[model samples]
Target: MSDAAVTADLETYLSERVRSTPPSGIRRFFEIAATMDDVISLGIGEPDFVTPQPAVQAGIDALNDGQTSYTANAGRADLRTAISEELSSRYGVSYDAEDEILSTVGVSEAMQLTMLSVLDPGDEILIPEPCFVSYAPTARFAEANVVHVPTSVENNFQVTAETLESYITPNTKALFLGYPNNPTGAVLRRDTLEDIAALVQEHDLLVISDEIYDRLVYGEAHERGHVCVPSIDGLRERTILLGGFSKGYAMTGWRIGYACAPAPILRGLYKVHQYMIMSAPTVSQIAAHTAITECQDEVETMRQAYDERRRVLVDGLNEAGLPTFEPEGAFYCFPDIRSTGLTSEEFVQQLLEEEHVACVPGDAFGPSGAGYVRCSYATGLDDVKEAVRRIQRFAAKHQNG
Candidate 1:
């Protein structure tokens, strides 16, 4: 009953993976910021906008009508049909509503389900570095070997097929993509995606494409639009597309998202989802259907606001002496902080303490993120402008350090 013995026994009870994996690098800074005054946080990724009124009303009405019970394991048929139609209209991809789509708690669960359904122990999943923090860990939780393929700001943090091919091994079974990517805010171009699709075909690998930010591409990026992975030739059968209402629709709390794939692959995800999550919240599904059917104007309004903030933040960071690549999508800008002679961890910690501006250390995403920091532009414009001012002051002090 000694303290050391008790500790040892506790350690023995948890799996090594759970014990060894570190906590999210994104959360600690936020927790610290919460305890401070006058802090401007460009840290978290949730949208600042309220959920569109129609969707909110839908949820309220559904709840008032006592529609709180679970839907079918694959989610409400109407939601699934709407999702199928939305994808078809937006991307020219068709999914059978009855069998090729499943609504889950969020893209997070869809990701977990995809990993569990398609990956086996010792299988390797190639994930580009500077990715969303959850990508590698979720695969690890599913007992897959995560190969972090490094991308750089030199190429706007994009992963090319040639680069991905170099990382492939016999054990490599899938590619996990999070385009309009987190931390870096990078989107894969059509040619690049085509190349990746070809590579996937050559390798005969499954793909888990997390496009939760699919609707958030901006300006010229929007002109090109998001290249829905399954919409690409030869990829539909092999790709699992994950999307949700959280980012673009401002429904993060609703916990509704979906996975689409060929029916057989989707059925696999459906099985895992049914057992792991009985169904997405029924009211959320109802609300999300309203989001899809009634909220296009609101979604566009939010996109325009984010686009405006994106320009200001990126330009400000560059002018502040932190070289930032213009993000084409999503709500983050990753700035190179190497000019300050500090590691990403050092820069963010010092910036937090000295300036009361909180953002995530880039290396939290992967090793390739070491010289950078992630600043989310999902907050108010004035807050972003003020954060830039604080960052400028901090950068000036340490520019030659």
Candidate 2:
């Protein structure tokens, strides 16, 4: 057969879900930015900081000590215990280290495990929109129906219990939450979380709460601190909490994260994890264990820097006529570009082409993001300042005709 026939045959064998889902909308912009010179990127969610010294040293020590092998499927027992203690101390929530926690490659794998473990084909998961790009697709990959429940800047990009209840159907099995949200940088408040917990109880729904950016919260949001979902009343038994060292401890390359739930639920995730991943990287697990135990000062230092960058970017975008809401968590600013008479994609494309500043279009996250663009403050302070200048120049050129 000819190459075209072979290609068509392979395509025919592909799963319908795999073929239908497009590549991440965020990747296209990153690809274009890669070919350009002197581009300032505020597109990716990754931190610019290096992994903390203690964690780095820990990984090196493990290697030097010749400790390189697959860990127990749930990851190193000590790491799990450290995580349990960390959560208990930080959020007033406790877990059985041996049974309630399962470490995976990263939060990405943890998310996939949760979706597969909890969702049956045709089951519906209600996800708030303008969320992380992966949440909906991961559920779809699990053969679950993804129901988007849109939230707007008017509501501060937070999904309410009332809004969620309206979307519920008989087949709805879970609610997927990514707060200290990607793209929008929105964090759910304690009161809102309480309301959501009550709703979840009434509906008898499970919740997958992705709190990867939990430690990166800022200002008033930080004052209240990050609320671990299971810590909320009525939620402990029903919520699967996904967290990682990527954002909080600058360990993206280490690829270490975990999922914690009630043991019965976690066992289902563990079964999937053991078959799919077996275990997280042993060295990375060691690094993360050190990070959890010996890196609080380092985490705080990086967070302070991100908060500073966040302030500069938010202020700069608003001054640039972009009308950005002040994000209280994570390191992103979603700025409205409608005033410049540009669609989110058009603004992002033109800005990249003309100003050499890279940002993801808001709609790439969800339709609710159509009039805005997500600019990450995870880049350097200098780059953020320069990107702000370029954006201002671009905005002035296109402002309301």
Candidate 3:
């Protein structure tokens, strides 16, 4: 407990990377909100629904049958097979389960493994701005640089092939594609995917497609679901598709996810998975298997509820005089708060303190998010309405003054 001993321990114990990495912004908001009573949180990006009953039953059955031993590091063969079939059936992308897939603790681990597999120190990863909070930090942890490509409101926050091409450098090793994106619900069309695929091919860059929200589209039935980079010509062999049971199947706490990539990349990912995680949770894998095969109806039911909430939240925000872009997919609304003459962080803080409504500051996502705020509609209809009422009252007082 002496000063010198403490100093020596601090110096010796912490890795430089761990010392430098900032706490997650989303987590910080959650902590602050936890101290306040009567606060309605529309901030966290998680499904409010419980895991479907069938998936729960599957896990119970697995445990009752005494099937808790470690499965293969790449995951249970049956789960991987189901993932492969699900990909082909859902996205029109073919992946061989035996050689090209690896189950992960979650899409979070899959993302980190993918980056560590391909990125080296000083190599750059092209990420579209207003992305998930983890992308830049994870890239940094992999000793890679991040080059953010800014997407505009005019473009619905979708990254175009031209925008992507502008960021390519000799050191650029991969592109992080988050469609039905976090914080913003922008989605890519098939033609846009093809264009980006061609550009990535020409640049010889790998694509890491984060399609965790693929099944959460909120628009018309005729509209396309989330598009994967691998589905585009010339991109299949070079793209790593990341999926999970969290968002789509309301299985967030189960921590089940998978990655589909080319054989060689998957081999490297498996090695990483083996050492870092050993294997994903056994019971979660069982639940995930059931989710992939028999939970389509549950997915649709949740999607319909999210769709309705999305409309209610967006319409309410606009009515409150906040300029919000209509989200085509996903369960978030990114609204411009610059007109209120406050920074994104200030707006969010004041909203939490004065209105007792919690939302994430857009700037937490990236520079492109500086003037906006991300409101997630993943909660109940009643909470969404109350949050909007609070926001409207806040906006009126702020604007009038």
Candidate 4:
């Protein structure tokens, strides 16, 4: 058929929900940074380290032994068992491997499936502002509305019970909690989590706690371990916990993660998983199982390195006259750029072009991030130092200008 004839007969069809979804702000920055040379990039949230040796070997062994076929929709029995045991031993939260956990392609897929399974059109989910970008869009994709609860830097970006209470609506179905968060790298202290837990319990809202960065904590002694909201009173039944091997074990390419929730939610999530992805890769599951069960020491070593990098980056930013908040977890330093009198996007762009340093704009996370920028310290210490120097030079030049 001729082009005009073909085009005239049919209008392009697309789902209204899909058509309305916004592109990921984080990814857009990454694409822009990719074209530049000599750029010291702090844009992405990935770990700089390679996957731990043990996990890599386990994956190799699985493939060599012909473990390539698909596994159960809920994931392999051994992997789920390992995950359940690890969660119980590490966090004091009990979940039945058979009925309470489902392995996912990644925490990303788990988030998508959870939203799809729990939310309906017009329902609302509460997300704290400057959160990981995926939460709002994922909720939107599931035909749910997102209510952003802003958390400020003065409070160390912690989401308090009062803030959560104020955002609750009649249609609110869940709250997205990301501790050791992206961009800001802020974590919720135990007492704060306890209060928030109590508030969620009172309101009868479900909690989708995104604890993917739980193992990346890098601060005081008491802040290192993951704190499950379920550990608090009455939260276990109402909370769906998300975790992954990507950040903790440097297994990003493996694409293996799991969700722990009530049995009913798990069932719904599994149904969605079955249709969307029959199972996470079988070899990756085996590798993840081994990593969680036996790779604690390796994970700790990486965490220590990240801790040093975090300190270096945060200190350097402060020294360079950029007001920065110390991150309790995750290998990122989000510094306020308001002093520069430039919007976050402009600040990042100028830094990348002039200083050959790449970092994401804070506004990409949410509206509250307008005057800030996120710098990832997940690279080598040398790279972090160099990036800081470039930033300092850029700041000095701009100040003089």
**Top TM-score hit:** 2
Error of 4 at 164 (Å): 1.4
Q: Write the per-residue lDDT of candidate 1 for residues 233-279, one digit (tens) a residue.
A: 88998888999999999999999999999888888888888789999
| Cα lDDT of model 2 by residue, 311-346, tens digit | 999999999888998798888999999998889899
**All candidates' TM-scores?**
0.98, 0.99, 0.96, 0.96
- Candidate 3 colliding pairs, count: 0
Q: What would the per-residue lDDT of candidate 3 be over residues 1-401, giving only the tens digit for each residue?
A: 99999998886678777677888878787899999999999999899999999999999999999989998999999999999988898778999989999999999999999999989999999999899989988889899998999998998899999988888888999999998889898888888888888888888989999999989896752175667668888999989999999998999999989999999989999998899999999999999999889989999999999988888889999988889998887789999887788888989999999999999999898888888999999999999999999999999877633
User: Which residue pairs show collisions in model 1?
Assistant: none
lDDT of 2 at 264: 93
Deviation in Å, model 2, residue 118 alpha carbon: 0.7
Q: Relative to the true structure, how large is the alpha-carbon lDDT of every model? A: 0.93, 0.93, 0.90, 0.88
- The weakest ten consecutive residues by lDDT in model 4 span 218-227
Off by over 4 Å in 2: none
